[model samples]
Target: MNGLGYEKMEKYYLTNLNDLLLCMKKAINFINPEIEYHHQQVAYLSYKIGIQMGMLEEELKDLLIAAMLHDVGSIAFGEELEILNEGDRANAHAYAAYKLLEKFNQFAYVASIIKYHHLPWNHGSGRSFDNERVMDQSHIINLADKVVVRLNRNKPIINQVNRIKHYVSNNKGSLFADRVVDAFMEISEKESLWLYLAYYPDSINDIMEYILRDNRLTVDDVVSLTDIFARIIDFRSPFTAMHSAGVAAAAVEIARHAGFSSNECKMMKIAGNLHDLGKLKTPKEILEKNSSLSEEEYNIMKEHSFYTYMALKDVSGFEEITKWAAFHHEKMNGNGYPFHLKAEMLPIGARVMAVADIFTAITEDRPYRKGMAKNDALKVIIDKTNDGDISKYISTILIKYFDEVVSMREKAADKAIKTYKSFTEQMKISQEDVFAMVAEKSES
Candidate 1:
């Protein structure tokens, strides 16, 4: 406890909040890899526009976060992807993005910007919505998003500049704010902005680093954000409502029993929460299916752990965390879908994570089948442990204090279910305002 205990640890999760946002986007891009990515380009365009508008440094910071995640709420399997390509017009995703992101104080202004990113100016009438002030930065995201969508990625970017500029100019004071358009028009004159945008994700990191040099996050903040990640990953289906939360709880207690320090236990929780982040790539139909998957569907499912690795591998402080999360499916006998590391290669932390994952999963009820009772579930764990797959030592620890571990796991599942209900409630809020706005224009 003396080494990395809570009191002595100051910067265990110390990270530029900017880095976390990019890592989140990596999980999201898995929604559809074949499509052209726009979040980074939109962030870069919005950054340039924010500077041209002379916004405060703090404003630019939130603006960048908002721009990168403007379309985050639309992350679903199939139809949602098409909706984005066709343009949302603040009708659905923008407000939904707000509902999901507003949970974190770190995304305070960022939530607001994403909520109104698709709101039209309506000839300057867009300054406020629902009697609350709309941040001007939202309009910058709106304009940037539109510009990126209008670009034909198949052609060289320079050739498409004029057409994109014309759309912005044509929508001035209607679809876009005057100030934002004026900024875009000025920047559009420089051909370099378009070229850089074509290939600027690495540079976006540099920009975010500069803007966030003074604003590092605490461990608690990072943990709260991971809770958000779990919600995003599991919210797609009711059967998985609290799967990640349960795993995190089971992992924390199991790691503690295995003599991991408090801070190390916290890292286990992060690993558990993010272990299923790749499931976002799994189709919704597959996720919600009430029957066993065919081999083809199972093959698709196997890819998620691999993608989970790819998404989290690059995040700062997640090197060990990534393996712990991604290796939950790996076997000590060298039989995993994505990576086949043998017993010698598997770390103790990764071993704890795998057992935690199995324990929580077998105990939790899903729509398709009833969860196993204590004896039944423990038997499953024991069989796997004896087969030289999962860690026998961790399995023994889990069974030693099974009741207390079950209590903690149930409490975590209960908390996560509440969050899922809250999100569904938030998701139900009507998206009629944009429709009404459209109707008004036709009448006039």
Candidate 2:
């Protein structure tokens, strides 16, 4: 039986999780340099394994997402998510994924499968944990995640086949569910699976296109996914916790004020939400540094805008929006970062994004400084525009509707602060409780 608890994540993607999946997966992988493409590999392996095990169509879909995001808890919660059980810290990320995933209505059941991907089969004890039935799909991902992590990247994939198979055989009843291992063995002998891993990154485009080819998405899908990225980006520090929300809100207003169509405004929001996508890869030391950044650190941080461009440029529907978001750092006379594009190249949307980003940055308080008052903020922006540092057309519109646009930014920032507080408050687990839960699992 599909556990009663596991069946409800059926609407997880609201049609297709591929809506903005490319950007989301790429950003998640950026958290650690060592695990590049880790999410994609896990997703592919899990998809093939689920198919071999005869999982239903929807279940396989859910399985694919869970695998791709299996490690998200590690990225989603940082400062506040402490793993007190140092001996069993590996389970911490999985547990964190559970906490975050369960909060989303559509994605809740998917949480049931992921919360225990690191849990062992233990000769059958793992089928249920803490008196709740664990989904079999969890076992499928358990086997897939294990195999990928153990893969020796240096050696040829074909050569490691036997060793991997032998390892799976040895642990069958103890470390993995017997049925799950048997299903993996059936697919493991296939030449295609090995070829996919052997020639990775090169095979990435083909695999991603094949998997996402039939996806049906709407604007809401893109918004939901991008909001997830925004939270991961903004939640990094309280000083800038609501920065993306403010930019997104302010950009939409600027776009609307500039006579952008309704659809264009929504796209503007998507771009605003993702403008800092590359910041995910920047070092935390640079992101949360209290004082002015060192010249070397500033240069390193400059790469974030380019990285953001790279992440979104390849996404299918994000063509125009990608430039708008990525170019938020470029200047009118060609002095801005990562790219030094002159005024002649940037479009109105790109120009609007640039000014909106500045508006949010100046009005938002930081550890070392206070946000400017309305008049002060306007003067600074107007001065920059006059000096050819920003867009004249866009800044003029902003100056004309100063109260309206700035008020919109403030409202967005206020909403984001509420979210940040809720997120942090929800995640505040004490050391004693965390250790107790781990201890309970060990003895189960």
TM for candidate 1 is 0.90
lDDT of each model, Cα atoms only? 0.79, 0.77
**Please, what is the TM-score per model?**
0.90, 0.83
Which pairs of residues collide in model 1?
Answer: none
CA deviation > 4 Å runs, candidate 1: 1-7, 11-13, 34-36, 76-89, 156-159, 198-203, 441-444
Q: Model 1, 248-336: lDDT tens per residue? A: 99999998988887777877888898999998888888888778899999999889999889888887767778889999999888986
Candidate 2 matches the true fold with a TM-score of 0.83
Query: Lowest-scoring 10 consecutive residues by lDDT in candidate 1?
Result: 76-85
lDDT of 2 by residue, 60-163 (tens): 76787687777777676663443222245546667667765665555677788888887778889889977999998888888877787667767778888899
Q: Compute the lDDT of residue 195 as modeled in candidate 2.
A: 68
CA lDDT of 149 in candidate 1?
72
RMSD of each: 2.9, 7.4
